[model samples]
Target chain A: MSAPAVAYPDHLRARVDDYLRTLRFPSRAPRTDGLEDAMRYSLLAGGKRIRPVLALATAEAAGVDAPDVLALAASLELIHTYSLIHDDLPAMDDDDLRRGRPTCHVKFGEDVAILAGDALYAEAFQHLLTAQPGEPARLLAAARELAAATGVDGMVGGQFLDVAGVSDTPEDLRRLHALKTGRLIGASVVCVLLLAGVDDEAVVRWRGFAGELGVLFQIVDDILDVTGTDEGLGKPQGSDERHGKRTYVTEYGLQGARSMAAECHRAARDTLSVVAPAGATELEQITDFIFTRTS
Target chain B: MSAPAVAYPDHLRARVDDYLRTLRFPSRAPRTDGLEDAMRYSLLAGGKRIRPVLALATAEAAGVDAPDVLALAASLELIHTYSLIHDDLPAMDDDDLRRGRPTCHVKFGEDVAILAGDALYAEAFQHLLTAQPGEPARLLAAARELAAATGVDGMVGGQFLDVAGVSDTPEDLRRLHALKTGRLIGASVVCVLLLAGVDDEAVVRWRGFAGELGVLFQIVDDILDVTGTDEGLGKPQGSDERHGKRTYVTEYGLQGARSMAAECHRAARDTLSVVAPAGATELEQITDFIFTRTS
Candidate 1:
């Protein structure tokens, strides 16, 4: 019977899309220059909304209602979207396709794309500060975590190392992914923990799970780059190798990388089993999906 | 006696520089990739430290000690520095020189420069959230104001309009500058008001003065771009005209722009006189310096 045919929380994603569609700018320019349109172009473009989904799942696992942290969750997607826009710039990964459409820079021109990314970054913090439902301290703490994960020592630092050429050793590649992609993914969960006032013991366990999930996600991504087709991936396959960038698949053989991903998946599920075994069904499903996603 | 010698607030600038130099990252990657150095290279390169100085001066005018708001004040400079790095990119203004040295992209490569700018943007919020001294509500308010001013309707929107080619009319030019340079400059003062718990009446007055000061600063900058030398301005003069960009001098003519700057200076001083007559000596001096600055 196909295991009763459950779904991956498209309802939560729809809620996010609704809130984002109705987002009202506190101020706007008298002259229109397509900045807002450009921002919404990539932001509203279809993706899995994985970061925000992670945030909502973390909230659910912690026994908080999803709507209570919806804005916080959506803010992660803003940061993620901004990173994608900037990453696709000609000077960076230089890809022309995202989500089966022209990349932000390709569609809107480079200057607008850069500004759109920047505006989204600023909007992420603004929306978190203004729209989140929490006490001031909790909100501030969440903002701090988001900023730290997005900053120099996190995603930006990781990208720098990647562009500058890491040594392709497992350690360097791990560090690169941990910074470039892992920190923000970890933050998506940790931010919910901060907002929900989760206890420290569970927080630590969740942190471990989040770290493992991040590694797992990156490893699966690397594997799919080798195995997936362009139509399935929504981007050109093997572009990573073309750019001479290091990945887990490059550092370790494909089978080796898949083994590592499976190990991480195991560690994550085990950690979750100990922490929120009763409430983390969605988190478990999401983990399985991330590990096995074809795209 | 040559009018008792006094200087601009080099002491406050020194304080900001010291705080910035000692900033500690909460997390870091195992590999170093020149991102930190790129951020520092642009941030520490001197440009009169006007934005932070404005913040500190606002704090002083409100009868608050500068050290209490030093981190908040310095955060503005970080945002300003990030904007400059991004603005000087080859896809943007395409400038190679800034503050009498190679631009961030020229010094650190384009990819590193982009990441450095991104890192600085993230760092600005992180520093404000973690390092700024205030109650949670107050700090959150300051952060919201900062983020709003730096986002789409503010600096980023203004830059978008500028790059996309405004109509070069006086209204369009005014709107562009108001968004691009004016919003963040205004936020520098208003952030202090929020942090210090200043009343609404005084906040409105300060906002007006800040608006005038921003216009004055941009007018003087436009004048200098037309009139100053490479050595004096620390960047190539006439580059705006060479790029076919419109400025205050282009829209209003040199004499007309100068007159407008003088009017703004007078309006700013008048606004300050009504609100902070006794405590705003530094504010008055800075206003004069901005109106008359050669660079």
Candidate 2:
């Protein structure tokens, strides 16, 4: 059975939505071709603004109300959108739908979709150079963190391992999730710390918290894959089963996955308490929302 | 008739070759599944190593004997390798041969080939964050230059336009080449100026020089496609004709294209004189190589 839907707090969600609506693009003569349009089509497709939200909440928790990092946050989403575009390619997962619309390749040709994804990756880095919440050094650190998370030993490595079908042991499974999803989610939090120029020790503690949150996200996602309908997923249901891909639910069973997510959520909250103590209300609430998101 | 094979400077070739041999891998347990091997396979596959040579030459021309930027130079090759890998994808050019050998997708399978390209991109940026020849600020500038040159208004955009067959005018042709190849070549020189902390005005001058060289490279390439044969060219000749792709030779005729390349080469040498009046023997030689090469 699925848990009741969690209400993500309205204030943070509103800010992210507003920012996404009015996102600035480089001022240049628009191409007659549809490359830029294809980029915008997928970028503006709505989804849970989870990564950006985590960035803002982490910044606030670190005792800074900086918003310059929103550009960084937005760039993060661009990178995320690119990953989705490529991962859905006919050569990859071969998905037909994403975020309730035809995938980029379905809407555009496969060639245009590939270029769109490639352009976004480049754009994300281009934007990162200019987006600084505090000092330029902080921005530089954020860029480094994002690059590391996106590269081998992080998202790309994990994806390679997944496509290789090498995860037989529980340890391999954990390593895969930690690299594939955990690094980027953790980067969202790390960007906030860098924006605030927090202490190294604090960055360490927050990473510990964020790592658990990332695992919690995958565990919940696995559970939802088993429990979710096509409507809730915004794509085909039972994709993991159909593809025969391994997941937390598959390894631990449905109830076991649920229990593991609960354990992780509790552990993540504890680390947050250690790092922020008097703050992190938003972070705490966001943790629960991760467990409860239907799509 | 093809020009005699211009002797590539043995000294520069040796340096790049020595650097590529036993290139360092980040310390980690090697994945047994051959993802790393795929990345290395494409990376070390012999090409001319032109981009790295350009970077090092530009740095030296800027009055810095800075070998430290070799890491940055090396990362430039990584990006170039990635572009080659993707451009050969089954969905893209679908080529089976590159540099007289099987392409990445042909040897590694399409899936790993895709991941290898993606990972190389990420790894390039990750490596860039550490590859400062001067100070951090200069490094930041270098990073920005690289990112912009790679993004929508640069290589990827030009590629989109090329694939879309959008260039019909001379203006469109110039824009296509400038974005596709010129910006990155321009970046190699720009990176050197940044590394040596050269003034902004100098950067503009060097870029003008590099931009002309980039055009010369392409003009000669189109000439080779028309005039050279399968053995000399390595890949099958007349690919542009077979694919019905547009080129300078197609638009201007062989003699006309040769005159244009000579003009650009002369213009580039003039700019090089202004920026590095005391030196640039290699730069001048390479400019001739771009114009006179048979393969």
Candidate 3:
């Protein structure tokens, strides 16, 4: 009924993987003593690659070539990977496994893991600034977008709220999700729009789509945490519950959360309709993928 | 003999302090639940504004206005502050104090401390890209310089070596300090040159000076770690010994390390003589400060 969730663009993800794989870290000395290995281990650790795939799809929907946005799109994965490494530290979520392997800190020692995360965070900005193909002004704008979304007001701030146990109310829970997860997801889309120099009106419309997509993504993540397997999720299932962290599912029951996801999907589709309908097939497919993903 | 250390430019440091003081972090919601407080707490905790002051001094030495480079200069301090926060984490150095106050993790809890550090890292790039007045290309190049010095090849990589206990030999220790402390210090000068668009030849000469400055700075740091007081350092003195870490002083002994610092100071002066001599006074003053500072 909902166009039978099109398969995640495995072909596109493969391309992204190849690009990431070919990249080399520059070191003052010829070797970084496996610091790069810690970074690569987590970066190449298999995930859905949903954030980057979203950036690529958004590029298409915005009438920009996917190749043109590949590096910028991939930079988001770097930030996401760094966050995972830090978030898994003993002091935070204390995750022991990630993507079916020992967590970064568990494998590399806590110090290397911390340094690896810091390196990746710096590399994300470097890659976006140096590798992305665009006008410098536009690239700067894109960099600023990425920075704003990752900073205290966005992902890190949201993380603070989550760790502080301050997001008790449903309203607070929504704010937490928006800041922690939603902002970076939105930036993945917005950065492409900025690079493309989209008109302000079009930006506003696409932002609406991005906003809904972020909401839908987080809700699905919460649902999967409840309805997933440890193997399938590539980490422990029930972590949210184990941590007693408030989630959409905790605020709204399971069925209610599903309803919210469905609502977001419809809203995303409706917002896409407001833009020119020329290259939106991939975006719609991604929306379907987000709604129906099991893990 | 060395002009009495020129008072370490407290007036310029005060300007950097005021600039950093007035920076208002943007948030989607009105409040970030003290995440900014955690960031501000460490950022304002006070260190000798050495890196930013180096940047400002470099700008002046290159015949550029300090105000033009102030934001970029201040950005270096942000990176320095973030590195300190992470370094003091329980999983890292496990320190309780920084700048005479409780370490970020000690004050804010580990999770908040980690997020605050991450936030500061993002904000460093954000502040540089948005606030520094320059051509976009030049600004992007400046950003890249900061990134290179902060990432795997530079500070973080150096930290990795230190934590891994790999720098056993004098040569490896030199490499470690160069990467860990020297690169960021060098970048404080290099970034200003990039933004100023100095000639390549001038860049090479300035880089030589910066390199010597970095070496001299680290040796002095090592000396202070041994001879300094806890009250003087605002953190525990003799931490390198307590941690069983290798340092210039550990390798060379206190007197030998002091001689090396003096040698680097001489080299820094010789390198500056290769460049235009009209604007070399502040740099010479800074070189003397590095050579003589006890804390």
Give the C-alpha interface root-mean-square deviation per candidate.
1.8, 2.4, 1.3
Query: Compared with the true structure, what per-residue lDDT tens digits does model 1 show for residues B4-98?
Result: 33457777778888877786444456565367778888888977788888899888889889899989887999999999999999989999999
Model 1, which residues run further than 4 Å from truth? A1-7, A24-26, B1-7, B24-27
- How good is the docking of model 1, as DockQ? 0.72
Local accuracy of candidate 1 as per-residue lDDT tens digits, A198-234: 8778788888989898999999899888898999899
Clashing pairs counted in every model: 0, 0, 0
Clashing pairs in 1: none
**Reference-based TM-score, model 2:** 0.96
Task: Give the docking tier of candidate 1.
Answer: medium
Clash list (residue pairs), candidate 3: none
Which predicted model would earn the best TM-score?
3
Task: Give each model a TM-score.
Answer: 0.96, 0.96, 0.97
Model 2 interface DockQ: 0.57
lDDT of 3 by residue, A147-245 (tens): 989998788888888888887678888888888888998999899999999987888888888889889999999999999899878899999999989
Error of 3 at B130 (Å): 0.9
Q: Arrange candidates, best DockQ first.
A: 3, 1, 2
- Return whichever of 2 and 3 wins on TM-score: 3
Quote the TM-score that chain A achieves in each candidate. Answer: 0.95, 0.95, 0.96
Instruction: Write one digit per residue (lDDT tens) for candidate 3, span B1-295.
Output: 2235455777778889989999776677546848888888998988778899888988887889999999998789989999999899988889998878999998889888888889999999989988999999899889988988998889998888888888767888888888999899999999999999987788888888889989999998889999999998888999989999998888889889988988989999888777747757767777888888867
Residue pairs with clashing backbones, model 2: none
